[model samples]
Target: MQSQQLWTVRWLNAIGDVDREQWDKLALPLSTPLLEWQWLHDLEASGSISPRYGWQPYHLTLWDHEELIGAAPFYLKSHSGGEFVFDHWLAQLASEYGIDYYPKLVGMSPATPSVGYRFLMAEGVDKQVLFRNMLSAIDNSCQQQQLSGCHFNFIDELWFAQFPAHDFASWKHQSYLWKNQDFEVFEDYLQTFKSSQRRNIIRERRSMSKQGITIRPLNGQEIGTDMAALMYRYYLNTNERFGPWAARFLNGDFFTRLFQNYRHRLLIIAAYTDSAAPPIALSMLLVKDGHLIGRYWGAETQVKDLHFNMCFYAPIEWAINNNIKTFDPGAGSPHKIARGFRAVANTSLHRLYDPRLKILFEQIIDQANDMESANIKALNQQLPFAKNTRPV
Candidate 1:
């Protein structure tokens, strides 16, 4: 009989500790740019995600002797602000039952709501076996550390399907997603909308031109230092303007580092009034493969319809022109439906260490998921697409 090879499991406190090439070898094959080595490294190196802000990097890596084979980016989070899955209700439920909820282990790209989170396994490996071993490690860690639970947010559908649901409860959440329907041009996109809304979109776009504001994409290398600095300023100002509700998890340093090192995945949609004037508004997005994910945006000056244009319309147009397949225009804003983005169900998996909490979650999860599914259906029914051109 052949002896089984034992996998070496290592808990890393920082992603930077891993060689960039090795990390990218696993991450680059994935559809999401947010999970790439440099992106996570910038979040840590910039101090944007750190213990001071309630996010402590606690990545899980598996080694096959001298070779790197598998990894999962995780955070020991003290609060649930940036996860975007909104488990405060669960926390509150746990509190009612005398369960501690903070200091939970979270798996996701910090502050990013884009989906497709999964363990990065090397090629030619038994992925199911790797997943089982990784889960065992995580369960043991949670018990050893007295953590309340482990939560994986915005999981990819493929991963979700094969996920061992016996170990964790599935929670459904909805996000605004726009899928390309093979429209060749921007106007072709508008044609998908109902007549009235189509006219409204045209008016909203033309309103910017009438205001002497031109929106353009500054992709990859075009996002130089000055524009990056401007973006950081706008991000800060935008967060401050939102008062207590702001999701201001990132800092100026994060933007600076990303612009310097991760420009290849960045796209900035900027609005300008004149040839020499600085951009009045800007929205930043991450592009990887055929997926476009909206991240942050801010404006130095208020302009009519600038928010809709810079954040949605112009980006959608650019996505079409660049042959991008899908767009997740960040989070919130139910108004995205009127502009053609449909509400799609996104998932998060949860496992509570306490037996009582686990029972409670299991008891209510099915009903909760059904309600959420119904909510997604209700939201999508409100899409402004023409009756004859329903989105598939």
Candidate 2:
């Protein structure tokens, strides 16, 4: 491994400090769009992920002279609000031990529950070397600051294995992922389900049309500020409906900025009652390199089966036509299984600087992971696939 001293390590107060072109050079090649420079920058510039909201931007960068080599987008979180990985139990444990858990360093796309998170390393560089040095830098920062620990959530599966060697324990969580099985059309996808589920899905998709509703995917230049503003209204409405469980992290400004700057990666699955009328409901999604992530949804009023059709069926249909490889229907809801989303493992790696907290984490991490694995297995077992084609 190369010495950590070879690279000049810098911790950024905000992503905007880094050049957009340089940041995208490392982030663009990644499979996940959440880590893209524009996304992170907008999150900060819009105040959705600011100190007032408990997420303080503290990105890490590795530079070789004036050239950027590696970057890890991190946050100094005062509370675990937007992070989808529920660590409240771990926080309680820390409290029991008199450990200050808040203000800990965390790495992940703010408010995004999808996977594929790892160090954004420049091409042609020694990835393993960069990975090691970055890990070392995080460890040093945590220890020097006397913070509770550092965690990397919804980590890329390929990078999950590398952390254990560097003393980071892995915590397993389950997320729903729909893989394209060479589905040529929406019906081809429907055929994967058992006859009972196939009938149910068909009914659900039809329910929308019966109510004089039509769903269509609008991408790139097709999106406008009015639609973006309406989508934010729906986002707020959706979050309000969830009440206590709502993850209403993004504000209206964030959505407006997203449409303004990141429209190329945006895909809004909109429901319309008339061809000339405005959409009554909208489900916003992000796409990059054939990977789709269902982000948010809102409806002007309650409509039967409208949620499933617009968010799932319509998006799935569009994905098939576009040759998208995977569709991550955001976080939450085991009910997605009935719609053919299989339960897959999502991992978060942790390193507690305090010896007591670290020991407790190591002691229970295996048992916790075992239980989670069993739960995921049970969930997949309930998948309505005709031949049980769950991922191995």
| Each candidate's clash count | 0, 0
Q: How do the residues 1-392 of candidate 2 rate in per-residue lDDT, one tens digit apiece? A: 24446679999999999999999998888888999889998899999899998998999999987788999999999998889888999899999989899989999999999998888888777777778888888988988999999999999978656545666788999889999998898888888888999999999888887899878899999998778789999888888888898889888888999999888999999899999988999999999999999999998988889988878899999999999999999887888999988898999989888899899899999999999999999998898888855452
lDDT of 1 by residue, 1-392 (tens): 11116678899999998989999999998889988999999999999999999999999998887567889999999999989988888899999998998899999999999898988988877877778878988999999999999999998867657755546788999898999998799998999988999999999999998998888898877887777788999998889888999999888889988889888999999888896989888899999999999999999966778999999999999999999999999898789999999898898989899998888889988999999999999988888888789556
What local distance difference test score does each model get?
0.89, 0.89
Q: For model 2, where is the 10-residue window of minimal lDDT?
A: 159-168
Tell me the TM-score of each prediction against the true structure.
Answer: 0.97, 0.96
lDDT of 2 at 131: 81
lDDT of 1 at 334: 89
- Off-target runs (Cα >4 Å) in candidate 1 are 1-4, 163-166
RMSD of candidates 1 onward, in order: 1.6, 1.8
